[model samples]
Target: MPCRGAAACSALAPTLPSARTVAAGGQPMQLPADPIEAARTWARHDPDPETRAELEALIARGAREELAERMAGTLRFGTAGLRGVVGAGSNRMNRAVVIRASCGLADWLIERGLAQRGPLVIGRDARLSSEALCRDAIAVFAAKGLEVRHVPEPCPTPAVAFAARACGAVAAVVVTASHNPPEYNGYKVYGPDHVQIVPPVDAEIAARIAAAPFADEVPRVDDPLAHPRVRPLEGLRERYLAALDGCLAPRPERPGLRVVYTAMHGVGAAYALAALERAGLGAIEPVREQIEPDGRFPTVRFPNPEEPEALALAHALAERTGADLVIANDPDADRLAVSVPGRTGGFEPLTGNQIGALLGDHLLEHASCDRPFVVRSIVSSPLLDRVAAAHGARSVATLTGFKWIWHAALELEGRGEGTFVFGYEEAIGFSVWSQVRDKDGISAAAVLAQLAERERRAGGSLRARLERLYRAHGVWVSVQHSVWRPGLEGRREIEQAMAQLAERRPETLGGAAVERVIDYREGAQARPSYLGRAELVELQLGESGRALVRPSGTEPKLKIYVDLCAPADGEIARIEREQRERARAVALELARFVGLEG
Candidate 1:
């Protein structure tokens, strides 16, 4: 089953024990060994009534399968930290899990002699159970005899990371689920460097968590916020806002453009509006319906800006206002989504790649420092590479996620390789400045607003600028396809698929010859620190096209990323259409090769 470990299996529910039941391919369903006993033990010690009752109900109903699933081992901590549904059981993210994670982190720091270094910073987002989780963590850290600082209020993820670095804290914890569904929440940890924890640190903390005392056994203090070691995060918001302001340029004149922005019911609107206005891009109209921080995210099915449906409200608002541009940020505001008015009236949201290219080009063009460089995920559009090169800058590719991108950027700066200017991932994450060594949607939105204003003043549009970029560079188009692979069996299927692909690497994809294959599983390439031991495969194709396959780190899905370049000289529209078709074709082939159904 691509065995992560016995503990993970214990936290994960296995197949049904029914005599007639079989696996996906008519194979015998192998049940987890004594998972019910483990589940009972976990339930007995669970501190949360909701989750405890959940386990009790499953036990009362004699739901062996459900109980086993709940008892299956604890969720493993990785680069993204702890993320799961909020419910009972060790596999879930609950008060007990949060307590253990926090205590374990405390133990790790203390063991490293970092407990006396500085206060640890903690922040929460507007999500159900987020505050509770944050409180649980604070109590644990306080009880561990370490100082702690809490954000003055619920803020974006980047703010917490920024606070960790700005405050010189030994570490930080952010209670959020990022763009996950409302039913899900997560715990993200950052090291002293303010970047997400990676490698031995994550492993050490995970081991400590696994070995921690039961929830009730862990000492808890009441009103940890009032404790002397607990300090208020005064002026953190202002500091973050000021950092974002640094990304701005003196606008010759306010473009007086109509812009509609939506926070997707996130904690970003307040910060986003302030940053945009401070950048002198003129005031922007807010999508009032989705303005506030509503953890329920009632307006959209998904809180991610990359989803077209998530931006539906913003698009409608933009059209009604005849807005010149549209901007939307995901729940935590670590990612941004921008849209320009389409020819047909509705606003057309720009793909993360397009936005990355535009932002990279603009920032590189205006860069005043020498040895300027931009960073992008290996799977992201290579168009940024061309853009950076054209502007006499270098483009560095890192493994996916801001943890890797930011670390790479800092390493380059430390080594005097170049000055870190911009960094982005295809999944709507961007880091416009180094102030917050992570994705800062607030600043990214501000930068884009400036771009739109400049383009408008030049008698052009962002889309026109994009077309010019295309005409200058080749038409770099890309598409992503996903196959839902849930549970342990699903994980096994993904592993088998990747192994099969490695065994028989495709000779061609979408009529393009496969030139080479890069298997990240083997660590064949120099990767970011946080991407240690991740299973991924990439195929380098002719014409600057690439096909990458990997299981989503945070979601139960197999993702296939495809990128292709086509001639952009003739009809830009025609080239775009043709290249998009080619990208889709390549994605389809990769999906098929990975045994995913269309």
Candidate 2:
């Protein structure tokens, strides 16, 4: 629900201000020594009238705890960049925070002489506040006399990434929360390499942001839409589409297959549908209700395609059309979700790891480029490594997120160690080719469509192809479970839980004895190739499987991932069933030991 300003946020305030007052992540809403004064200071400079009124209402009602929570700490740059619920205060995603972040980025760029390197590119999605935030960022950039190239309309996140590299921009900023809920919005920054900002750079930009003036004090020009530096992304889509076409195999053999595609009420339909058609695939049937871009995302609880519920409408359409496959993209169209028909007359959604493995195998099988290699997140299924090895390609595992994946790909490509043929994280994000160094649902969707069609022409389904790959590379199954802990206290609890688990290493997990416990934080030093510092724990359970536990980089939850595999000794069907059952049992046990039950 949209928080109704201060009143709605303050309804739960208690008699006396206490340090234990819960707010975001269940963290104690420690009241500032002078909460009322702090609220007044923040409200005075708040640029958004709605958020200003929100703070004023809380101040008027002596909602000190609520006010404190809102003003406790400014939103800092993280793995996902600046993101939070849209509302008042430094901690939220209101105009004030956006302006400050822009100013900080501007200052960092100018200080580093990056403004002289190239123009900055900006793009936005169809989120409610996206346009407004884009304009706000433009105002700051223009005031600083920096050249800017802006996408005139809502575009996929990858478009901005591609434009940043293709346009030779020093940095690019996309005003989107990606797959976050409707109430949230975010700003993601990409460097000249077109990868997300990492450690030292993020810290430097954050320092500049901390030094930026308050929202109201920030200077701005009259209409950023009329600014001279602002120019539309002319010919960008054509270039991106051409690059996408390069991801598919030559002499494409697309069968007459029925496909159901949905954008999940996002800005992807135009790009995705066009890509599918360009791939010479069969007729496309879109989920009518979800074909258009609607920021409200009224049809689903969350806009993320990774969530099974988000694809309910697409599944229904698939069933009605007897579609051979279902493909979906999140709101920004940067991630993909694939579902195939099941025995019970319903569509079965594939896990991110499953999709990754399938795509990795398919891409490797049709290798055309030299030095072909694959990349996957460290927590993703290890089956991709075996697939790459079987195909005589190298596989590298990096920290979670496409930022690291893309960065590592570039590093490899630069040194001629390998060329990034394909990359994916176990979160429905994939980069079919290195043309765009980010997870691209539009291109990934196109490649998947072509692959599915080819499989269909061979009188086989994706399921059959998957089974074949499993046979070639032993049956491997994986599952992900998350422990939700919202608010600040929840974050602390998650940290404590991780510490407890790490300190008290279990001698056995599930029914198997633990062979070794790897703490990534400690092992990072030993492994120089590891990207960044991460709080992760991995348990190697002999031959049964492996389990990895870590706190979510973006959300207030503890994520646990488990993988189970067996040698392909029996019939494919029996092996698949046994492996799935074994995976489920192992996942359940890991969850009990490290997730919800723990």
Q: Candidate 2 residues 1-598, lDDT tens each?
A: 0101111111111111122211111121232457688778878877889989999998889997777667768887766788888888777888878887888788777776677667999999999999999999999888777789999989999899889877778889999988999999999998755678776678878877777777766667678868897777787788888866666555355448788999999999989998888877666899989888888999998888888889998898888887899999999999999999885569898888889988888887777666688889899889999889988999999888888887677666656675567889989999886557689999899888888888888889898888887888888878787888877777777888787887677777667888998888775666635455688888998776798889887777888888887888887667767767766666667666554553
User: What tens digits encode model 1's per-residue C-alpha lDDT throughout 374-396?
Assistant: 89988799999889989989998
Cα error, candidate 2, residue 80 (Å): 1.9
In model 2, the runs with Cα more than 4 Å from the true position are: 1-35, 250-255, 571-598
Best by lDDT: 1
Candidate 1's C-alpha runs over 4 A off are 1-33, 523-533
Scored by CA lDDT, what does every candidate get? 0.80, 0.79
What is the Cα-based lDDT of residue 75 in candidate 1? 73
Best by TM-score: 1
Clash totals in order: 6, 12
**Candidate 1 least-lDDT 10 residues:** 1-10
